[model samples]
Target: MSRDSLSPRSRLVHDALRDAGIPGEIVTLPDAAATAALAAAALGVEVGAIANSLVFWSDGGPLLVMTSGAHRVDTAALAERLGRTSIVRASAEQVREATGQVIGGVAPTGHPAPLPTVVDEALAEFAEIWAAGGTPHTVFPLTFDDLVRLTDGQVAAVD
Candidate 1:
């Protein structure tokens, strides 16, 4: 889709990518890609190639975990790894306030402020990864290294 056709949130993500010198175009899908499974189906790629942006509440406040679709975040392990007291899932309102986007459409970038991010190392297995474009029907492609660089995310075994 053209830049002009992007939603406000998508526009923010688009701009963020551009400013970061990341290469990708936001692609609007014919159907909603609210879940990694749906996004993978729409893109005809393996589900593991979808980077799921998840927000959580940690001792340091909001934390973003960009995980691979093939696995689930191990909160306990993550807490231990981060040396945090606890890491719990953020409520919808908390997510929106932190990321400026809804749960299903949360992107790795374009947040109101920079959030401490941890990206799943497993995602590096895929050459091209797809992430939400600030909306359920939109997405963008990037390399694993580009994603880590764009978010300044620490590479970890989050799942």
Candidate 2:
């Protein structure tokens, strides 16, 4: 499948990538890529090459963690990194409300506001990475720099 032929969220992701001056084309897979392992297997890449857009609720507000698939975001460590007391996983509704996309399909971009974003340092190992394009079956290729610029994310230790 192609990125052009997809749902509204996927299309929006595609357009956003172009608007952000990033070279990304939508890739549709037969499998439901709801997890980093699944996406890595489907794309035939390292698990770290999958940029998992994770949503969390912090004392400050909604936080977006663009983490590498190979590692889990240590929330307590992340909270310390952000100088916060706590960080909790966002509810499904909170995730949708904050990112304007479903839980399994949230992209790094296309949120209503500029979410406080943290990008995993592990993702830098890949020249190109794939992130969900606002849908479970959809993804778009991106570079670490482009991902940072597009999401206005800060590079940090997520795990």
Candidate 3:
């Protein structure tokens, strides 16, 4: 679909993408793909190619982890990697407050403000990566390099 027709939230994400010089555009799925497995299935790609946008409450504020679908973030390991005392999942309210979007549709960008983001090194294995587009049913595809450039993320082994 055209950028002009994107949902309001998605339009924000689209604008962010374009402003960042990313060429990929958002696409809406017929069904909601709230989970990485579901999104990978809908997009007919390996589950590992799905970049899950996970929000965490850590270091006294919000953290965004763009991790691979095939694994979970090891909080203990991540804490060590980030030099933080603890890392915990953010509440739905906190997620919305930090990202300006709900849990199921939190994109890596388009937040109310900038966030500390981590791009999984494992995601660099994929030729392309897919992430949510500000809503459950919308998504956009971009390369691993695009993701790093878009978020100014720290590349690390998050899982």
- lDDT for model 3 comes to 0.94
Pairwise lDDT winner, candidates 2 and 3: 3
lDDT of 3 by residue, 11-49 (tens): 999999999999888999999999999999999999999
Candidate 2 lDDT, 4-95, residue by residue in tens: 46887877777788789987888888888999999999999999899999999999589999999999999999999889889999999999
What's the distance in Å from true for residue 118, model 1?
0.2
What's the C-alpha lDDT at position 152 in model 3?
91
* Reference-based lDDT, each prediction: 0.94, 0.89, 0.94
Model 1 alpha-carbon drift over 4 Å, by segment: none
TM-scores of all predicted structures: 0.98, 0.94, 0.98
Clash pairs detected, candidate 3: none
How many clashes does the backbone of model 2 have? 0
